[model samples]
Target: MASNLPAPEGVEIQEQPTAGAWGEWNPTEDSVRPVRGKHRVAKQRGGLARSSTVLGVGVIAAVGASGIATAQDRPQVTISLPSLPDLMTGGDSGHGGAGDNGRQTDGGSDAEAGTAVRTGVIPRQSDHRADAGEVLRNRILQQAESQQGAAEAQARAEAERTAREAAAQEAKDKVEAARKAAEAAAAEAAAKAEQEAKEAREAAEAKAEQERLAQQSGSYSLPTSAYTLTSHYGDSGSMWSSGHHTGLDFAAPTGTPAKAVAAGKITSAGWSGAYGYRIVLELEDGTEVWYCHLSSMSVTSGSVAPGETIGRVGATGNVTGPHLHLEVRKGGSTIDPLAWLESKGLNV
Candidate 1:
């Protein structure tokens, strides 16, 4: 029989009969021990080839797993294969057996695998960290917006509080100002009333004083109407029986009314020797006043008040014209009537 198995490297092929073995085999360790200057075979070529094939298959499987991993990690990815004609154009015709074995290992016919390869497409992987970053950015922006809204609400609240406080303060200020204004007006009114009262009191006092003076000892008035001082008392002239004037002479028209100088009583009235229509008055101070040369006598023997009309003036009692001879006598001695009247607070 022809052997189909290849020989190991550094060893010759020979037909050898073995008593215990049933087929051709490699040299046993006991029979193939090498001495010096002889090389020992490391591994058979067929075994190396089988190991290489397994490593290639493992690498292809690892690449496919990496592609699957990429598809899982990325979006919008596609997986497709090349066409059979493209694969055949890139491979040697002598590799048909290998391709058939590869097709068998991949669980498909060569045509189907080639067709799948031609149609399959792969896409790039996406970064999952980028999507996570986008989510983080959106969260940050939302947080920022929330914080801004909260801050704005707080600001609005603060503004409202400030406005309320200001309004309250304004009301308080207005009340205070109104109070002060009321106080000022009240004070002004009080002062005006006080001044008016003071003026009224002073006017009343002055009126009372005038009335009192009219009733007191300081009261006096003119004794006659429309009279001129024609002769004074004790004038050195030949108009009297004693050869001198004895009283003051007031000359006037006839029928001029003569009044009492002060409050007195009429002691004597009527005509006398060398004195016509005469009247005499006795005062409270024991003083006497004589009125000679009267046109008429109105008072009888009675008390008289100051400023009362006693008689009228005329040419009587050795007078030159219509005149009055007024005499003041104390203890039957004559005195100047004008001086005596001035001493009694009379403005003659």
Candidate 2:
């Protein structure tokens, strides 16, 4: 049997059996030939069919669980009907229906409902702080306006006070000035009264002195007989060199008797130069009397008598016609005869 077998060429043979404690001859290819489709179909039908049924059942169960979960996630709400009084009032009431149900019943769609829900979120506390800050700013501005008004009022009051004070001072000044003027007027009136009184006293004294002088001079008689004055002393005319007649001239008819003016001694009875026939008489108290332009002399020199005939009126040297020139002298100076005669109680 070994001689008739061929030589082993690409054949693989085990040298010894595995350590399973059993040694067995390898089976030939004819005994382990590849079976056709029937056996594989039988094997698959036994185990794979049962496993596919289990997997299908698990998938259906998962789909059912997902649908149940989706149903559970949908929004659910409960709504209680409002009370009759709340429904009639129409305004917001605590007993109103649930917010979601009210919105839906009031015709709010899903999108509007979502917007209203988002708007209902509570505002931050910081937003309230901002509002409060705005209110504080407005209050501060109002206070500033009030303060400004008060300041203006105070300024006006001050201005009025100043004006009043100025008016008061002006009135005071006017009163003071009036008082001073009144005092000045009174002083001027007093001074004027004093001056008038002084003038009156002086006038009275002068009158008294004049009366005493007249009383001391005794009475005298007329100087000429039936003679009229032709020229008075200090009379201006062309007959004299000095433009003034220094002696009184009396005009009478020729041979008119000239009497003594007073009780006096005959100082001279002669034909003087200018006075053709003249007589000079001296009284007791140094008074002198002159008789000029005489026609003739009745008494000689050194004769003394009262109311005695002294000379006769005549046209003599420098005489225009028959006239008597009578003159009176006191202490060798000529005096006004008319005034002297009047002082002696004679209206000559």
Per-prediction RMSD in angstroms?
Answer: 20.8, 29.1
- Window of ten residues with lowest summed lDDT in model 1: 71-80
The per-prediction tally of clashing pairs is 12, 0
Off by over 4 Å in 1: 1-218
For each candidate, what is the lDDT?
Answer: 0.65, 0.60
Candidate number with greatest lDDT: 1
- What does candidate 1's lDDT look like per residue over 1-348, in tens digits? 234544445323222234455442223343233222211111222333222223323333443555443211222211112223223333322222232343211213333433443234222224444675898999999999999999999999999999999999999999999999999999999999999999999999978766665555355667787878888888887668888888888888999898898888999999987888899988898989998989899996899998899999888766678988899999999999889876665656
Q: Backbone clash tally for model 2?
A: 0
